[model samples]
Target: MSAALPALTAPTGRRVRVLPGVYAPQHDTHLLLRALAREAIRPGADVIDLGTGSGLLAVAAARRGANVTAVDVARRAVLTARLNALIARRRVAVHRGDLAAPVPGRTYDLVISNPPYVPSPHGPPPRRGSARAWDAGPDGRAVVDRICEAAPSLLRAGGVLLMVHSGLCGTEKTLRRLAEHGLSATVSDVAHVPFGPVVLSRMSWLHGRDLLDRRADREELVVVRAEQR
Candidate 1:
């Protein structure tokens, strides 16, 4: 069962509620939307919100006057996103399929994601296992890697790509992967949320980085922005 999620009201007069245990869009929606709304996106630019958990970004983009399409592999997420869009009274295309699969024959001026980026040991499987929702491989870059590889084809010339993951999951590795895929990345913003013990266990990976900081209680979260080369 998915965890219970809270309902949030966007400053744009939109109401959003993310389903529990299924990658709620409430957490990072504000940080991401703030950065995105400040960008030079044309009034009617095409946008894709990959991993559109609750369709937060998709709804945000639509409100910003862009043609937005949200894609996700989980049926529940897709349904939730579409419903959220409907409740917000925005016309967003919601696709139920893996990354980039349902978006074929179309390209976007901007692509964004807040994918599941926590690395996990090969132990007990999740009561709700969703490779597309989380489990970013041993290094926690699987989904990011795949997204980067496919982004160039999906992004238009000069299109921008924005993403949020974790500092523990090898931010540098993500930057390098983006480069390999012809994307250039820079840390536009970062947030610290005490994610508790399980999250702190991965802190060693972030120790030497300039961007990470540990809280007294120990949990943390990061938001990174990348652009297509």
Candidate 2:
């Protein structure tokens, strides 16, 4: 018999297989952390990565000399993140819980996440593929809004928060929600990539509202940076 695969090891020292819809060590997570690392990340800064599916971003922050906490709702995700952290020889607290609830008695200097932000159809929820990773509930803002709502309490004054999601959820709504939560938010980046066919439904809604004047930017990923006020 042939030798077994390396079990989908973590990239950059953190790895986790089985993220429900996608394979482990998610790509967007790596990208998000890469962007954050490019900024001025302070040594020993406390950082938290919500929805840390594969521990990619959490490990990156730890490698950057920040004390990091990565949380996920799935038990598999939590265990995987912890294992990846160990393999990387980095210290990280991996918690199994939803959103910011797992973390208590602490605040972070940086909070980053790549949450489920895609709007799903009105019927029975998707049964597979990035569906678990992509579904953001109803209008796709459910989880995102919760994260924004909790950030002010979880972040230190002037702490930075970064998130990545698509434009279909109304980027302005995200910014407005951040402001409501006392965090100054702005669009930092947008990229064009295939959002998969499931997102086409959102296009119809946009088109109906005369929003079709703007191009179909499946790649229109938004990176919002918020500073706790």
Candidate 3:
């Protein structure tokens, strides 16, 4: 984890096509990208980017010379990611499906995700639209839990997994979950960012659930890095 990163904004050189209903590259993406930049990926390292919204991370890894596959559940996301990769002139295989489900019978040198971790009072993540990119279940652990469960199977003996999510979902639980799988894990980086429109709209519900203080307007986003033992 030691490479220079550009500013915590969208990459300026390459244009990303943000289609409607797809999550656009934002602060959370930048935070995770910065964390990804730290890793010293060898040329052609096998990498899979789960929940690849616009293929930003996958393309970034490809730029670093890793073989990347970008996976997403939303159809729009899959298309947008592919287009973005094409625009960036990066080699990325874009697939449409749930996290890591589209690819089986393969282990990677690295796995990365910027999953849907917003604490939504809604029943589950939307099956379509931009909300699918961020509205996780009540505790926001729905997707996070799945990633933790899949880590062991998805990684090679010495492979790494890097995921970014909100602290509202329980950072300790994430670390514990990864450790339970016999992987060494830690919160590698954190950013206290202001709530976006989605969370801001659900303020009352989140406060009712005691997930946030009445006056709290910002939340901490953390990148959890884990390595196979």
Candidate 4:
């Protein structure tokens, strides 16, 4: 049997206030944090947290003395991140916009995200509602693909990216896409987590797409780390 994963903990250990409709720090969030913890974040290093959700990753980056910027398309998420940063006594430049849109022509030493990767039976991700936090179009590449396409441009030379998503979205495809974009990428970590409500609700569809096993109750989450040479 695989070892049990550690309990999910907040980045600051203090209470993080999340606004309604914002994505809360969960398995994927903590998994990404674990990956981020392994990287060497120098004081004043530039970092960007795309799809920052509740700004947990941004706060962690700021706490490490990095100059951190966070972006999210959801207004509630943007507000939640700003509030959390304030509560953490950390300075995070939070922006409200699509991934990487707000920071034109800007590159960072580290880019991180836990974007929407759950394959949705719905035709596309909903523009409004709580579902936006996890729902992506069928095949689950809507947002992840965009990030892969933009990562190389978003990173400074020798920079790194750490993104976490469910393996159902095609881990190999992500690595290949990054490689095609000239980044050396690999799966740095993996975790088998039981299907959450979102995935459980679409089990039949996932099975139809061969993305899930008929008898399996868990799904794999992978942290893809890619470096810009």
Q: Candidate 4's residue-wise lDDT over 1-229, tens digit each?
A: 1123122247546567777678888888878989998999999999999999889999999999999999999998898888878878999999999998998999999999999999988889989888888998998999999999999999999999999999899999999999999999999999988779888887888999998878777889999999998
Model 2, 6-93: lDDT tens digits are: 4565445533444344425544555576568666778999999998876777888888899998888767677767766776788999
Specify the poorest-scoring 10-residue window by lDDT in model 2.
1-10
Top model number, lDDT: 4
As for lDDT, the candidate ahead, 2 or 4, is: 4
The local distance difference test score of each candidate is 0.72, 0.74, 0.87, 0.89
After superposing candidate 2 on the true structure, give the runs of residues whose Cα lies further than 4 Å from its correct spot.
Answer: 1-27, 122-130, 200-217
TM-score of each: 0.81, 0.82, 0.93, 0.94
Q: What is the Cα-based lDDT of residue 11 in candidate 4?
A: 51
Candidate no. 1 TM-score: 0.81
The C-alpha stretches of model 3 lying farther than 4 A from their native spots are 1-13
All candidates: CA RMSD in angstroms? 4.4, 3.7, 5.4, 5.8
Which is the leading candidate under TM-score?
Answer: 4
Off by over 4 Å in 1: 1-6, 9-14, 123-132, 196-220
